[model samples]
Target: MSRQNQGNCDHQKLISETDTPSLHEDANTDSGDWFADMFADFEPQNTTDGSYRGTMAKIKATELHYQAVFEQKLVEANTNLKRERIRVTIKQTGNSLQLRATLPLKPGDNSVGKQKKQYDLSLGIPANLEGLKTAIEESYELGKLIARHTFQWNEKYLGIKSREKQEIKTIGELLDTFEEKYYQTRQKTITSQNTFANYLSVIKRNFPLTHLATKENIEAIINSVQGNKKNELIAVTSVLIKTFNLGFQLDVKRDHVTPAYREIPDDEKIISAFHMFEKFALSRKNTNISDEIDTWEMWRWVYGMLATFGLRPRELFVEPDINWWMSTQNIDHTWKVNKNTKTGYREVIPFVPEWIELFDLRNSKPLNILERKVEKIASVQNINWMRRDISRWFRKVGIQFQPYDLRHACAIRAHLQGIPIKAAADNLGHTVDEHTKTYQRWFGIENRKKAFGEVISQRSLIELQKNEILALRMENETLRLEVEKLKLLENV
Candidate 1:
């Protein structure tokens, strides 16, 4: 054997003799001298200061150890390749490693007059012991395929999508790349899909395709918009910057405000709207069209649930568990929001418990109608469709208030009924601070007057009682004086 081959064999023997280092070092173990035994001749490479100490030193040691181990693995791989039809080898570039296969062409079938063609298939694997093992296995598999003359340059061998790299020259192309990468790392769900849709909408609406995706261009696009739209643009643009590592910071100040809820309808208006819906549905019942009547009633039920439960519009279709609350078998009326919801699983109580009976919510779920609708729609569209449909229906029925007005109205009602902010926030599936910020802004003149009026009435009643007590005391004193004077007169 050559001296180089002998050195590799000795290195392999030395590694086998000692305890193999784990990929993740134990936290309790001393970080210093942790890889000391494994890499006695460790030298620092691609590091600043060139000191064998601290976290950087440990990382350098680990990298060098992985290199040594990979070299030993390559020696074993070379031995295995002796009997294989294809010449398989390991190729390392920076921190990543890949397998290169040289396939022999058939006689008189040379392309470009070459006897063999080498293909470097990048698996995007780390240059660690585990990655080396995977690459060696892939090489053997490739060898088998080449031996059978069935080898082709494809994802089957490359371990990635077999598509030509598309050049991203414009913001639009960059967004496409970012979108694919964004979804690829996440588990697809109705909420995530909807979130992506909203993000893409904002990005596409604000950013022009002609502009290059640079730090200056992104900032310019963000600066052009104002308020919440500016904040939204910043957020989605930041995703692209981060995903692509476009060395820049999104330090622009956010639009510091929440949507104004002061125009939210009062309880009287909300109740009035429900009554109008009830009237409309009653009017529809005489039309002799079952579907039309069912639609009206179903919508009325949705309105009632929103007002009674203070539920978000999307939560209407999310099917938050309230059957137990509605069922006669259970006494607890606390509804459970689904785990898949934006705020996740939490218990909620009816803000207007009496509204349940008033709206006939207990007896009228319209379950069959909702099930049919949900069945026909795609899973991702389930919540979105419900929200839009309810909004359209409300407009068609000539209701002045939006669907979320009911939720805002419910929040206000909970506050008016002296519900603790924390308790209300918990029921609403948000923080106490968020609940305060949202509802407090909407606690306008009307709410303030109602609150102040209660205190004023109580004060006035107390003042009247004190005046009456003073008059009674004076009368008693006068009667005592008259009685005493009469007794003296009689004695004389």
Candidate 2:
């Protein structure tokens, strides 16, 4: 049998030999008898073979031994308490240990409308050595309280202070508290504030002031949504729940949303869109020459940058200067994405380096779309507006793909050009895993076939060339043999 089972059997035999009730009730008996019986075979056998299983077994054995010691200490404390007239005995009740004492209660301390003895003052802690020591100290404090006639029946003594009723807060009121704390702790950027505001709206929609922030109500709200939305709801709700210590946890798995694959536009389509952008600019120009400020060329430049660099639509509005683009420090001619952009600052290299010059991006002026300041357009409130305007402009130019598709196209371009996954990810401001996931999912069989076809074609061409060389050598040998045979005929 295992040592642990043997020890347990031994413990049971020791308990059977002594009166079990006496062990609980009688404190006058010497604790040493119990201690000796419990620990007679408790010493570790030095079986410390360095393995996880062995270490765990040792730990478990040590824990059981300590528990036995704690129990002995409790019994010893009772004997001391009885001799000192403390009038309290420590008892092991279920999994927890408590001080059992008969103390006089103050007036109106009982539901019977009369003063009487109160028993079982809870320690409100786990039954361990530390808890035992703390409970003994508390017993001393209780004894003093009884001596001073200050002892009373209160939730504090019963360890129900936290369980006491508190005023319920409205969802709206709690949201106000959450907002104040959220801003105080988090970075106070316009984008961050706007994102928080969006989260607040989600919370408010599901749980208005009329709805209480109860566990049941939150579950109901979570259940109302499906897929990624449910996960998002749980995520935002957790922030509020944790902030207030709401005494519950969300135990939901993130429902994986199968994203729809967006096809990356080819180089031809992107180049076509660049030409269309010029026509779009001409179409937007006014009959009154004074109104024309070359707005279309600015947008065309934006399109070229997006197509060439794989920049996020919002990233264009982030403050970038000619110096930033043409910095001497950038040996690779890579430009820095602004720190305020979504993924923060990253150095982005164009997939097609020649596009920078072809689009005349080096000589490009600061964008002046709609005469709006760069900061104003890129601000949290208007960033969406900027994206929408870009989208609308694309539609006017008869482009079929969305603005973000260009970013995907760039990723594909980088993949086709044999860019390392890490390099591609770093340039695009994505993690390697994210880059792999995005491209590999849609990088698909067609691209694979194309790559394989190129390899096969090269191999076939080499094989054909080798065959031609062999045929030429055979022909030359045949001509030499024919000439030698003719010489023999001439000698005859």
Candidate 3:
């Protein structure tokens, strides 16, 4: 018989032998004999009770032998090859084949690490040996074509359907699509929109949209940049991952990629920065009485607002709608955070009454009491620029500090004042655990020890009270029993 005709007979025989009622009844006998013959040269390390498992083992061994023979032929065909190899495997699904072709690295490969990767091609093919052999040969040829282009394979090369080809978009193109979807699907605040725009700009600046979608390019870009620039690179990579995930929902083929972030330690200690900033703010208020009082007062309010409310620097100056600031009839009472906050909406009351007076709430349109009319609503860039000016001022006064340090100072003050950790976190619009992790050192060892001692003392007192209650109960029971006996004796 021809190989194709014999394969057809074998397929029919396999289905008949496995599924027929009479064969199933005598499966142990018939299948064991069949598997023993098929795997005569192969030995199974572990024993199986059923004939089905044994048959499967024999089939697996046969497939491995077939793959090994094909691999040996490829090796013989290419004598000087070092690392490249063709791996063929039949899918367990019974109607598919898989081919993996690894391309050897060139002498000057610019990949970050020396890891072997391959181009995989999967095809639906018949289960018969002859059909599998033909599919494997076709896959080998296709893999060679892919390798010749340095593994930059695309759907066009494989002649995939147009629908499938449309899914294979470059990373940059997918990001643009993702950004469009983001604006359409999400209700973005002005701050959020600005942040998204910045992320898009950074990604486009660093990566070309025309390049193929691969993680290796991301790695190379990250490696090419160093120092502070790496932070921007990592930020871009993070946005890319988010964009790709969004693209996935639209059937785009941009896989997620992660770029490693450099872990640079903070040099400015929170407590030290706080003290220095406080002195600077106090000096501004105390020293200049005549010409610069307005300027000094503005800095004072800025410092006080950050320290008192833990407000972000930009929050104080963001577009001055009524939502930005709220106050009660008096400056001393708790105020509502009427606007959208970074960690969602939260209310923060000042510790001191003077903090609230920093805002000119008498006017229907709230403005900073110290801000000029023209400067009432400052842009985010101007806010940041002012913060830099404040930093320089601190240096001129022989202090090292930034505007953000005041917020940290607020957290530390909250810890020192014996505020409940959860309450403090809520006031700052953060979780208790996050608040603790960020400012645990500022809480001081003595505070931690005091907290620990209080807990231990409370537990000890509870145990002592429990013991006393138990002893009293026992005494009362004894007295009751004696009284009952006396009553019985009197009745006798």
Candidate 4:
């Protein structure tokens, strides 16, 4: 029941459609809301369910192709320091149609951990079947994830054949292999590994295994992602698909085994992914990563930079500007845009005067706060990792966070500050129509926040009474003195 519906039956309650934010610096709309509102309940299909019946038919035909080979099976147990034997009994559950490893811990641990255990996943596997390709994708996917996570933590898998046994696999198989490998070694920033991860996930969830590229699968996967992911996906997929079109090139590369695999995902189906990020910043706190940073200040910085500014970790080093906005603002209490914004294209965000002052102070600091957290940056392949790490820290302090939640929060903040559609566009360097059209979803929360600014947000902010205010005043005075000294020197 957003102000939009006013009282319109909660506007797709089951789907929990996201709300809008304020205008951009306006930066942009609030949420990305990319996916179509596909809120159909998971009604178990009887024979009469037409869509299920058809999907089942297709699934049966596809499963007929694979000959699932269960290489080995065993249960492994470990005794904790408490001398408690955490024995996990594994079983190949569900009909042979799918192999689901029933863990002793059912409904699994959905939290941050030392070493992430693997979940036995059903990759669109049918309920019951026979000679139809022995559907063990679930087991296979689980094994791969386990091996991958184990390798990452440098943890040992004493049980049966780890994934080191397999060498040649299809594109989908290759990606799952890499995701585990990349996660294990803690290599997060690499583009290819992440790209492959997205590709495989989409394929696993939506597309069938008959082949790498199909019209429907491509469209479906495309429809799966929206916004920045859509753009990035498009950029990567387009390049590869075009290469895929080069038949001889693709063949030669296939023969030689090079970096020329172009599994083209559909463009039209690529939804605006920004909406997917709505909410969750203050959800699912990650405790492990919290142990890494000294203060929540760093998390706030990360949130402001990414969620508020849309600056990637790599883009943190924007060139110096006239005011030299290293981080915050200056003497006259105004924010400064760094020359890094030299290409000078910002949309949906504006260099507010107060913000300028904030950055002016930040600018005075050394150019490399990054030195403190290189390890963290080095492992940032997926933004989700950052979210988890931050969430972990906040959770330890009793806060919730979801990955990329900051970005969403920032977008919402920008819009709420009453940033115009065009300024918001300039702030983000995106288009304006988007700002106007999504006026509701991306703007709702922001609108609410703006509508009731200090009452909620400034509550804790008001905690900056006594010496905290003194510190700010002193800082501002110091800048003023420095400016005076500079003036005298110029006059001399």
Report, for every candidate in turn, its global Cα lDDT versus the true structure: 0.66, 0.68, 0.50, 0.36
Give the clash count for each candidate.
Answer: 0, 0, 0, 83
Predicted candidate 1 versus true structure: per-residue lDDT over 1-492, tens digit per residue:
999999888655543422223311221344233233434443333222111132244344544565565577556555555433335677787656777777665334559868777766777655544455556566656655655556665555555542333233688877767655454323345555776787778778888888887777888878887887887787778767655545468768777755654477887787788878767766666688776676776788888888888887776567545456567765556667765565556677889888877887766447556656666766766668778988988986779878877777767777888899888877876666667766786778888888889778889999999999999999999999999999999999
lDDT by residue (tens digit), candidate 3, 1-492:
999999888655544432334312322333223223332353322221112343344335545654454345334323312112323332323343444455444335566775555534445343333334444455445434443444544553343643363455676677756665343222344444555666777777888888765666666676677765665676457556544442221222333435332221122343243344446556677665553444544554455566567766555554433333444443444545434333334457664344454442234322344345326434444544655665665565454455655665566667756688888877765566657754664545654676678778889999999999999999999999999999999999
* Number of the top-ranking candidate, with TM-score as the measure: 1
lDDT of 4 by residue, 1-492 (tens): 478785444334311211111210111222112111211221222221112233344334323321121112122111110122111222345432323332322233455543344334333333321111223222332334433332222212222232343233343543444444333212122333444556556545544444455334444555566654444444344433432221111111101222222221111111112222222333434545553333444444443444435443333433223233432443433223332221222222333334333422253232344334443443324343644565564454443333234333444455666566566644543345433533444445435555577566666577657569899999999999999999999999
lDDT of 2: 0.68
Local lDDT at 381 for model 4 = 46
TM-score of 4: 0.32
Question: In terms of TM-score, which candidate is stronger, 3 or 4?
Answer: 3
With candidate 4 superimposed using the best TM-score fit, by how many Å does residue 13's alpha carbon deviate from the native? 82
Worst 10 residues of 2 by lDDT: 45-54
| lDDT tens readout by residue for model 2, 170-234 | 67778877865454323445545566777788887777677788888888878877897887798
Clashes of 3: 0
